[model samples]
Target: MTGTHPVGTRAPGPAGQWLRNLTTPPRGAGEPPVRLLCFPHAAGGASAFRPWRGLLPPECDLWAVQYPGHEDRVGEPPATDLTRTARQAAIAAQWLADRPYLVFGHSMGALLAYETCRRLDHLGVTVPDRLFVSGSPPPHRVAAAPADTDSVPHRMHGYEHRTGTETGAGPDNEQHDEQYDDLAAKTLSADLRMLAGYRPGPAWRVPWPVTVIRAAQDPDLDAAAAAAWQDYAVDDVTLATVSGDHFVCFTRPHDTVRLITGAVRR
Candidate 1:
């Protein structure tokens, strides 16, 4: 864990302010050897990863990406363009390029992380040392749902009814949280629309190591879908499975931390 300067207390410069606004540093007192930038799934915010700070290795620092329209940035409008969001995230993460860093994203966030890497590559910026994608299939393999389909929150509510359960329930419950407010629902719909319309170019390849993590019983992503991630990696691709459904990061935090640390240490 690495210490964060007091919020709003960074030096007077664009770069300093960017760091202050976009990233939440680890809680310890010194900079760690490597940085891990964690991106959240649709309708999720940086606070979703708050538990990880204590579980990750001390040598690694955790920085969660705070997208607009969620958590403390709730007043800002959510981004609907995947390319533009990726470009902005790449630029915001540029400050971490001075050190070895890896990018970790779950579900929709996996796609976002991949696109950010591509944007960084296009800008000749330092590419991530590794990319860890959890519970998402390769970009090309993802089937586009109709852009006007039921939004994630609506789908989540339906799942809740079917299961006769409440939001934020345990491992046996549906992976999605059904407690989203109106604003979250609207933001998630926009993100889903972007995801539905996104189609990666054929020549694109992640020129670094990739580790694909799958939830053992994830309904949304099966073994074949998880394995398809190899198609987008130019280097080695390791597939690992953990216990739980799509929200394993929340349901199996210890296992998630172990898997992540193992991948980072390798």
Candidate 2:
């Protein structure tokens, strides 16, 4: 079922605002042939995919999920349960289920995207055409990292520095650190705790194709790890390698966009 409503048409009032908050604005002019629902890494928000709009095909609209306790939703409390978060996301995105769309997630976001697909299936909504998992291993293979070992602020600092270097924004410093730390620390801590406790149940194969994107320089995930995604996909499972590390979504936007568009077109 394709989306019959034209682009920019949405319900009015508080309900509209709530749905709008979960998605990024469409960068395309007309109704897109497909929608790309993007999910960010841990401690990251929809803004992480803001740079992707310019690189994507004009026929493909990008909608980045804005989880609670981040970005514009900063006023809300962080979610502690992955199942609850995925359920909420599935509900928020139900309006777009009739449209041809795909889900793209990086790292922690990959898990969320997959879980959300499951919820959509249970709710009898249209599942995505494909599931793109980047910079993450399969659910069963994922083991929680040691908790509270890394400071939220410090991680944010490093992320900012890496992003700056990749975008030619120059070197990040104490100033940037101070600015984002307070806004992100508490929320990030809560997110980390949530992540630590998450353990995927026995394999439940998805009915759609799964595309795994591996970063060549990403120390955390290798080819073998990415290949494990096959266990979760009953359909085709393809692995594509790109340059850069875990932050390849930001650093290699063009390549990332190319891979995504290619998958959709196929």
Candidate 3:
């Protein structure tokens, strides 16, 4: 109930239905059941992947999993635990039970997709056809403190990457009466709180081929961290470099799309 929903779960209210539908195949039948589920970093929403639809092959369906707290879920409370986030993704993966699919996540979203696949394995469910991780280290290599969410302002710190670009750590003019500074702090704190509390297990691993996309300009996504992805995949593994900082996927839409589409085609 707290994280992303599986494909067929009874839709929630207007917002819930929107989230659910986002995970469904957009085109009636042109797109095949071979889907690509995308998870955004902290403070990111499903809409972050709107540009990806045009980049993939017709055999690939696109679904963007919306984590609570951004976009339509703006007024709703954000998730505080990685476990909860993973569970939500697992639930949504069920809709693709009969179809072959892959998962693509960026930064915090990368970790979320990895853990969700692990949870599916535990449940004897079908793992993703492939795993695409961008700008994140393997779960086994992470050794950070649990996110701190006790206060409104402290939570956003968990989402800060080495590059300092936070998708959700901005001013909230509508809610905080133009107290932009305080609003930014609160938004950042929430994202940080969610990140700090996430602790991945050593046993978690993906049985499918895994691809890692690194931002050439992102300080957090160095060669060493990108190489660490080799330990997580059970099948094949590859690492590709792209332009821009941590937010390059958003900025360099065409190149990112080409890379993603090319990967799926293979």
Candidate 4:
């Protein structure tokens, strides 16, 4: 059944493809023992998970969900219907039917991960053995963001975390030109529209284990928001706390991968 969860962006394109960096060699031959699908946040692109290639666990092959209208797929129309995107993702993942796999999503991508899993099960394909949700509130909690045109910049800044392309000078970040800011505004404008129209259909659940991950310093998701996932989970959700802020996964890729691999294996 299509479901809802209390939980929880990017210029995400349509979902017919997966972005992968093959640097991490699989364990033995054809495919690894496990597969991990990484979904990105709003205004974010699959390139965000490129660095994770090296950090992949030996038994797992990492595949980042590639939304249309971004990077290499820039020619295609960007995906706006979240559910349809999830269904497409599920179909694209049919190849993983014979492999043990895990799914991970951050922020808005968390919702995508959950929905994609549901689609897989509905298709009688294969469901992930484990699903990890990070930095997102549950489905019922996601509501249309207020329409305050003046706050678009602030909201754009928020989505930048998902984009991992924060402007300005920093050790890990570099300065971008005014054009980048314009692009962000355009993207956020589209996101506001999506949020304004999006309505979570119903709560969804699965028999597989669901891990709710929260960053210790996340400003948007407090302990209560993180725990709300327990209500929608089919089984008692596993709550995990890790170091960093909302964009923790990108900031600490190694730690994030380590935590995921360790938790799933356990």
Q: What is the C-alpha RMSD of each candidate to the true structure, in Å?
A: 6.2, 6.0, 6.1, 7.1
Question: Which clashing pairs does model 2 show?
Answer: none
lDDT of 4 by residue, 1-266 (tens): 00111111121233234444333443445644677778877656565676677776566776677665544444466677777888887887776657787899987789888888888988988778888999888876766435445644564475454544423422255444455555555554554455555567777766789888898988757899999988777889998888887776886777678768875542
**Cα lDDT, model 3, residue 253:** 65
User: Evaluated with TM-score, which candidate comes out highest?
Assistant: 2
lDDT of 2 by residue, 72-148 (tens): 56667778987788888888778666668888988888888988888888898988888899988877676544544
Estimate the overall C-alpha local distance difference test score of candidate 1.
0.68
Give the Cα-based TM-score of candidate 4 against the true structure. Answer: 0.79
Runs with alpha carbons beyond 4 Å of true place in candidate 3: 1-25, 29-31, 145-185
Q: Is candidate 2 or candidate 4 better by TM-score?
A: 2
- Tens digits of per-residue lDDT, candidate 1, 127-162, equal 878899997877877644344355456654443343
Q: Once model 4 is optimally superposed onto the true structure by TM-score, how far is the C-alpha of residue 2 displaced, in angstroms?
A: 31
- Which of 3 and 4 is the better model by lDDT? 4
Distance from true position, residue 118, model 1, in Å?
1.2
lDDT of each: 0.68, 0.71, 0.64, 0.67
lDDT of 3 by residue, 1-266 (tens): 11122332223443343343343345554445576777877666666665565667767777777666555555567778887878876876766646677778887888888888888888888777677888777775554533334532332333232223223322332322334344445545676677776676676557777889898977667988899788776666888888877767865567766766665643
- Ten residues in a row with the worst lDDT in model 1? 1-10
How does candidate 2 score on lDDT? 0.71
Question: How far out, in Å, is residue 184 in model 2?
Answer: 2.2
The TM-scores, one per candidate, come to 0.79, 0.83, 0.75, 0.79
